[model samples]
Target: MEILLAIIVGVLYTAGVYMLLRRSIVKFIIGIIFMSNATNLLVFLSAGLVQGNPAFVNATTVDTSHLADPTPQALVLTAIVIGLGMVVFILALKYKYFEITGTDDLDQLKQTDEHS
Candidate 1:
């Protein structure tokens, strides 16, 4: 299972990077989404996939021998939320860019290169 997931992550990264290098704004947005998802999966997998109970201490004595770590889960969850926000902001930027220039092709952005 871990091997399969690793392979999937690799594929996701490759696709994301390929899309990111394209000349279309939509493809760039998709690439960002794929890359973010791949990153999140990588982080989650790095935490190990041992089958155990939740990290909750019960009663007086604290026995954490077979408990699962919660930090990675929390981190991944937070990252997902942040990634969603970032994607939304990027989409809004894309919309504004299109509205202003009426073009989604990144190559057309060369018009602004003269100013810089």
Candidate 2:
């Protein structure tokens, strides 16, 4: 199960990187979102997944032996939210660029002295 998860994660990372190399601004934004998700997954995996423990303390128990590590989960959760915000911001930038320049291709953004 762990190996399968790792392989899936590797594939996601590769795909994200490959997509990010494209010239289209929209694709680039999407690729960045994918890459962020991949990074979050890698961080989560590195923290060691618990088999069955939840991240809450038991009613009477005080020791921290049986509960899952909460830090990684919290970190990943925050990262995901931040990633979503970044995706939204990047998409807004893309839309603004499209509206102002009429193109989404990075190579086509050459500034002209007359068009300025």
Candidate 3:
């Protein structure tokens, strides 16, 4: 399962980079989303998967060695919230840019910059 997840993470990262290299603004946003998800998965994978091991311990619990780490989970959750905010901001910017420029192609942005 770990191997599969690692492969998936690699694929997602590759796809994200490929999308980022595209000229379309929409594709760039997709790339950002892909990368964010990949990062979350990578963090989760690094923490190691422990089946039947709870993160929280109770009075009846005698062994703490098999307990799962919660730090990565918290970090991933925080990252998800931040990534969501970033995506929303970027979407708003894309909308405004499209409204004014009437184009989503990044290459057009170069021409505008050159003129300025």
Candidate 4:
């Protein structure tokens, strides 16, 4: 299962990077989303896969060998929130840029870049 997930992560990363390299603003946004999802999946896999195990123990003397680690789960949750904020911020920027420039082409933006 881990191997399959790892392969999936690799594929997502590849696709994200490919999209990121495109000249379209929409593709870039999608790439960012894909990359964030890939990172979340990675964090999840790093937390290890346990079956039929409790996440937390109530007793002070309880054994923790079979319990799933909560840190990675928490980290992934936090990362997801942060990623959402980043995507929203980027989308806002893209919207404003489009409103001003009337184009979403990276090549056109580069012409402005050279002028500046």
- Cα displacement (Å) at residue 111, model 1: 3.7
lDDT of each: 0.91, 0.82, 0.92, 0.90
What does the lDDT read for residue 52 in candidate 2? Answer: 79
lDDT of 3 by residue, 45-103 (tens): 89898777878988998988888888888888998999999999999999999999899
Residue 36 CA displacement from its true place in model 1, Å: 0.3
RMSD of each: 2.0, 3.0, 1.5, 2.0
* Leading candidate by lDDT: 3
**What is the number of residue pairs that collide in model 3?**
0
Lowest lDDT 10-residue stretch of candidate 2: 107-116
Each model's TM-score?
0.87, 0.86, 0.92, 0.88
lDDT of 4 by residue, 1-116 (tens): 88899999999999999999999998999999999999999998997877677586776847888887888889999999999999999999999999998998877876645755
Clash pairs (backbone) in predicted model 1: none
Candidate 1 Cα deviation (angstroms), residue 39: 0.3
CA displacement after TM-score superposition, residue 102 of candidate 3 (Å): 1.0
In model 4, where is the ten-residue run with the lowest total lDDT?
A: 107-116
Q: What is the lDDT of residue 93 in candidate 1?
A: 98
Off by over 4 Å in 1: 60-62
By TM-score, how accurate is candidate 1?
0.87
The best-first sequence of candidates by lDDT reads 3, 1, 4, 2
Q: Where is model 3 poorest over a 10-residue stretch in terms of lDDT?
A: 107-116
